[model samples]
Target: MVALMCAEAVILGTNSKDYQIYSLGDRIFCCAPSTGIERGIMLEISNQVECQYRERGIKPTMDQVRDMLARKYENVSSENVLLVGQDRHGPHIYAMKGIGIPQTLIYAAKGKGRDDIIGYLMHNWKKSLNLAQAEQLVRTCLLVGENDYVNMCVIYKEKETWAKAVPQLEPVAIMAYDTESAFDDMTSMGSNLSN
Candidate 1:
């Protein structure tokens, strides 16, 4: 799993099976080792979270979500979970280990190929990245080979809030280029993820 905050959006990506990413209100939730039980737990939590925000207009804090997960951790099969969202305080990334307290992060990756993904992000991520650049970065980092597919979610606020999840059935073709060239291409194509 990979979760990062870009200039105007939070991006989450994973190559895991069984639909590991979900939307909770305005937030994007991602978990690793997705199983039937974990999916069920996530569904329950998402409903509760959406209700809290919809009925009371109160967004649940990362800590609150973590506490909720802790209460149900014993039955879940997930080992790592990431939550990304924005609030009055701005964008936030929360990384949780099992039922542990959520750790605030600017970017996070877990499960298989985590080290490689983290290293790539550490060397490549920039604060100025737009939605296209961030999405491409995630796609590049997640490309293990010629046959891997990626599931991605982009969470951004326009007038209200929006979350888009795209599941790629075909393998993403990897390209080699410097950051400057990639940025130029993205700009020329006007490749906004929201579009």
Candidate 2:
């Protein structure tokens, strides 16, 4: 169904307590959970933003980009996240609903267990977190939940006057470890529990 699946992006706003922690012109990176059909939507939206920026010699505002996506996507359902550059403003983060609603996220995660993840953030999120700290918090939430449903992590940061193309991170295995190796930990623990 081309349902836009899961994409995660974080935007620390002016009101954010950790805003001052990051330098003035850091780049905002948009990450797609995995390379697949679902990731296509995010790519297209980003492409559109880039095209508009190139033609206009200015980055489109979130609202403008949102409208463009809404028109292009029409009724297609899918998961999408965008952290495109905002002209003079800092980076803007948004999740585009299949129905074309560009919902802004403030330290929010989308996709499976989105509700629970949001709740978790509400309880544990701190205002003093820097960019890296915020990213770690998101990573921790996914890891602690053992959310196998999501497998993609992308980082977004805004730069000075122009938006730099943030690179995708190398894929890594998500594992639960208690100092023991994978096979050793699971098998040994299994035997003990059964006994």
Candidate 3:
């Protein structure tokens, strides 16, 4: 029941066209489409990777993403996943999956069969918006059965403004950090990059 139910997930991976990979702490920020359950699996991956990164002080690669996911998921393949978007301003979201070798980049993976395939067609043809922009345009969404049957709601870059798209679930139990503190850290990192 849980495994088969429909859902949607978005991951914005910052792999600048040249296959250059960026990593932060124990997490990698990449966007992929998934169901509610799969999203949970990804969260598990993030948590595990965080611990590993802390102890070993290493960045997670596609293979590491694989290892972290292999235990809880089956039929694990890149075709079933995608790393979307570009994190132009450093690692915005440190989210990672898998734990073996490196997985190439793609935005979201569609499930097998007609509905999924056609849904992708519509997403590409009709919507005409890149994953990032589309993801940022939603309020309330539900991923139902097939093709556009899914929907999404999110709090994009800003707090007051919310966007809704077809097929992303609003995350529960959110966490907030001090923006000023984070800004200071990023400012220092930027200086280091300049040097």
TM-score per prediction, in order, is 0.69, 0.51, 0.32
lDDT, ranked from best to worst = 1, 2, 3
Q: Which is the winner by lDDT between candidate 1 and candidate 2?
A: 1
Q: Write the per-residue lDDT of candidate 1 for residues 100-160, one digit (tens) a residue.
A: 4567788998777888889999999998899999999988887854428799888774433
Error of 1 at 95 (Å): 1.3
Worst 10 residues of 1 by lDDT: 157-166
Alpha-carbon lDDT, every model: 0.74, 0.49, 0.38
Of 1 and 3, the candidate ahead on TM-score is 1
Question: What's the residue-level lDDT of 122 in candidate 2?
Answer: 81
User: Which residue segments of model 1 deviate by more than 4 Å?
Assistant: 53-57, 61-63, 74-78, 145-147, 157-195
Taking all chains together, the TM-score of candidate 1 against the true structure is 0.69
Ranking by TM-score: 1, 2, 3
What lDDT, from 0 to 1, does candidate 3 have?
0.38
Measured by TM-score, the strongest candidate is 1
